[model samples]
Target: MDAVFVIKLSALGDLVQADGALRDIREHHRHAIITVMTTPPYLRYMQRCPWVDLVFVDPRASRFNLVALSVLRRRLHKQHIDLVYDLQQVGRTRFYKRWLFPNGSWVGDVPGCSCYLKRPKGAAAADHFAHHLRQAGVSVCHTLVGNVGWMADDVTSLMRQAELQPGFVLLIPGASAEHQEKRWPHFAELARHLLDRGYRVVTVPGPADLAVCRAIPGDMLVPDDGYYDLFVLAGLAAQARFVVGNDTGPTHIAAHLRKPGLALFGGHVSALSTGLQHTCFSWLEADDLHKLPFAKVWQQVEQLMGKDF
Candidate 1:
């Protein structure tokens, strides 16, 4: 294979959850140039991706701008893409498959395509995604183990400034802006519960999380500014005795780091479908995000923390 192209644009959480599929691609095409078409928001994470070779930022106005779409078509044609993997498998990439790379070999949900992973009756999204790739001829296991190169020096410096210790528990109380329902309102209570149990609590705020952090009533080291780096955040999560968070990128990433974590979810989405795949991690879901009582969440956190608590 000269070059393989993958389309997974926008939604950092979706990208993060697609770890297993990426692993399959990397393992299958070790010598092939692997490229990904993603959005500007995901550039930082995609830059450090060990699996992908080229990271193409999708032209913002391509959907309606014929000129922009033409430019993209010319670029793909020049590259002579050997295979196209439509991981997003949504309307936009479907457009690309139809108009831009009409003759390209594809492995995705585009109808009549040679390969499509049939999700079983109750398969998790990660597992189903991997199964699709595997059934389509890529030998990939369903499990995902994310390998992130943490920024140790930056985390150390920041931890020192915040007086954060090794046993601190990281609390992630944020979700995608559109899914703030996934942001549990009781996180502050959970933080206080942990603090009262003789553990320090730290909150990592994403762009949509600062307001949530500000509403807390206790002493918490919310990032003042210029402290939002996923690399450092990964390092901090890796050090925590236990991590708890809503189903957000940082929370999912924290669990991906293989830390002892509890990813609390609401009924809006399935925990099995979107949560982490670590044996050390546990998923708790309720009918509604707001209905998840603080006491039950605290219990799960303690279960994960145990001796550390």
Candidate 2:
């Protein structure tokens, strides 16, 4: 089987987007082996996804590390990888492509600000990458492919351990980095309102956002390190009556899973970057979720939960 290597290292949302590109490869070249190289944390996410036949983990070392580069090169050579798709398209990705497959074609974002302008509105990041793939002779459906298969068994076990019950509202109160801006003031009020409404508000915070969860008063369910995998998180999201969060990875994952969700977006992140098509709602800057009263969010949550009131 001829192999193609897709390199996308970190950031869960970006990695999730790569799943679409992988789907494109599979749809177009069913016989070819499609492998992805990402960070270790994302391995479990990729493991359960059927689009990828193999996964390679890039080490923690700097991309400029000669030893690491040599190892990566040797691995690609051993696998007889015919093509390299640099989804990341960072300086390191360019370096890796130059060393490993100097003669191979590299497909990724065009240079500079042009990349941002190329992305279409309401299109998921994966759709943007798939468009680039088409230019490279790989044709794929324009539709976005969501995450594959349920880690239901894993999620059930985690929920059991946490004593989480059905009809609980899942609240994710943080984003990965500082600039992302978590709408905590709104979330705090939202959490209290949901708790009052007879729904258990479970707070799931990533490592960086633990402080936000700690601030939410009441018994909250935070995933132990064991269930940190995105797929497992998606399964957990599926179990929720509704998910409320900022424009973060887990929120995107929840939306991708078609979980009833309300994504609160401050002026920073747009609906085009994070909104999901199905029952998902986006509170954009124009809507101003941060400034809106908790009652508004509660009303949206009620609508998603099918509560007539």
Candidate 3:
């Protein structure tokens, strides 16, 4: 393929999960000019992505807007895209297939496309990514081993400025606003114990999480001026000795980076479905997070520490 397009948009955690899939695509089509059609929230990160050669903002405006659709069609046609990988695999992307690239070479769940790979109901995201790629004749090594090594920025100066050092235990005490139940209520208590044990606790909160994170006892890693971007968040997780957090985007980054950590989850989703757990990255699930106590989570932390305590 001379030109290719991969569709993935929105939500920070899902984008991080697609790291492995993106790498596999780039490696398989090394000679092709690969582009990612994403939303504005992820435009900056996609521009820095090592795998894709181009990034296009999918306006994702109302499908009924003829002017917007016309502009998108014209731009995509200019690329002369030879193949499209619809990783998004949602209603919006299916609409794109039917409207913009009606007959062009397309690969995804959409029926009647050049290549159709249906995701099994209730299949894990990582597994589904690998399955479809292998079905499409691409080697599927990295899709199951999500890696964000390339997405990190050097935080030496930032670390110094923040009066923190590497190897400190990282704590993520907040979840997305809509999923407040996902936030375990014991981080403050847990941080106190870590502090007593002489472990430096650190937290890097997103814009929406500053208030919640600041209340937790830790060396808060925020820009003195504005905010922390994806690279810096990955960098913090990359350098952390151990991570303890709710199931949020930063915790997913920690897991994929192969950091030794504990991700707490409620009954909303299973850890297996997210595929974020590993030998080093462990999880503890409860039917209700509010009832999950700090003692149990602390025990998991001690276990992650490998009897060094």
State every prediction's TM-score relative to the real structure: 0.90, 0.80, 0.96
Q: Residues 1-309, candidate 2, lDDT per residue (tens digit)?
A: 777777878787666556566777777768888888888988877776777788888775666587876776786788887777777766676666556666665565434321222456556566567567777777766326655434333577777887887767778788766654556356777777777767778876667777778888555555454225455666777888778887777777776666667877766656666425422544434344457567766777777668442
Which of the numbered candidates is closest to the native, going by highest lDDT? Answer: 3
Clashing pairs in 1: none
User: Better model by lDDT, 1 or 3?
Assistant: 3
Better structure of 2 and 3 per TM-score: 3
TM-score of decoy 3: 0.96
Model 3: residues with Cα > 4 Å off, grouped in runs: none
Pick the TM-score winner: 3
Worst 10 residues of 2 by lDDT: 109-118
- Report per-prediction Cα RMSD to one decimal: 2.4, 4.1, 1.5
**Ordered list by TM-score, greatest first:** 3, 1, 2
Off by over 4 Å in 1: 60-62, 118-123, 141-143, 149-154, 217-219, 222-224, 275-279
Measured on C-alpha atoms, candidate 1 has an lDDT of 0.75
* lDDT of model 2 at position 126: 67
Error of model 1, residue 150, in angstroms: 5.9
